[model samples]
Target: TQLLEQSPQFLSIQEGENLTVYCNSSSVFSSLQWYRQEPGEGPVLLVTVVTGGEVKKLKRLTFQFGDARKDSSLHITAAQPGDTGLYLCAGPTNTGNQFYFGTGTSLTVIP
Candidate 1:
């Protein structure tokens, strides 16, 4: 079965610290979606990189797709308290009806 796994389930750092999150899987996916969610609200789409070797950046965040489409990485620069949230990676299969979400990464940026 295809599954997405994330490392460093929890992270706490200073306001200006930088961090990187990882998403890995053994199965290939048609598309991979990245989301940042706050408590009590649904996850909001951050970036979706479907093609292998694709890289996209938003403001202070950078996302990269693995050449094999089986892994991804998210790097955040100059972290702030407002940037604290749950980061999730989802991989959609051919059916497109379901998605495999990563274990989830909880980040806390202390002021």
Candidate 2:
């Protein structure tokens, strides 16, 4: 079963553009993590949003956790070619026993 669903599975944009991708799930989670994976490499953790309705910013990237703690969004500002990669959101099950990863959003930032 798919625990997490990510919107806009495929995205292609020009440099200096902005974009937002979403991750949603029915079950509530205590915390959620966002990751970015480049071609032929492992995913690197971007940030972990723990509290409900929390917003975190890393450079030009922004992450927001839903007020209900069941959804999240990632927004990128001033996209660059170096930003091209797959963005994935992951979280633990309600019981905190297992983890689930979103289907992912593929981002292509053309120079």
Candidate 3:
């Protein structure tokens, strides 16, 4: 089974600040994806990176896939209070049918 891990499980920052969250694994994946969720709501897909070294940007948020496909990162610029949420990274496991999600990063952007 492929296992995914995230670093700095939690983060709190003031509005207009910037932050980066990382997701890592020893197992290579076919694709990597990022999501953000708010309380009492389901996670929302932000972006998906399918190729090594791929980068996708959604407004002030940027997503990247490592060259080896074993890691990924999400960077948020000029964060807003609305950005406060749970961030997650996920990818298909070796089984292909199952997916593995990182521990997650809880970000609180204070106004």
Q: Please say which candidate is ahead in TM-score: 1 or 3.
A: 1
Candidate 1 colliding pairs:
none
Q: Considering summed lDDT, which 10 consecutive residues are worst modelled in model 3?
A: 1-10
Q: Candidate 2 — which residues are off by over 4 angstroms?
A: 95-97
Q: How close is candidate 2 to the true structure, as a TM-score?
A: 0.96
Tens-digit per-residue lDDT, 1-111, candidate 2: 788999999999999999999999998989999999999999999999999999999999999999999999999999999999999999987688888999999999999
Model 2, residue 82: distance off in Å is: 0.6
Angstrom error at residue 3, model 1: 0.6
Clashing pairs in 2: none
What CA RMSD would you report for each candidate?
1.3, 1.0, 1.5
For model 3, how does the per-residue alpha-carbon lDDT over 1-111 read when each residue is reduced to its tens digit? 428899779999999999999999998999998989899999999989999999999999999999999999999999999999999999986677987888999999999
Per-candidate local distance difference test: 0.92, 0.96, 0.92
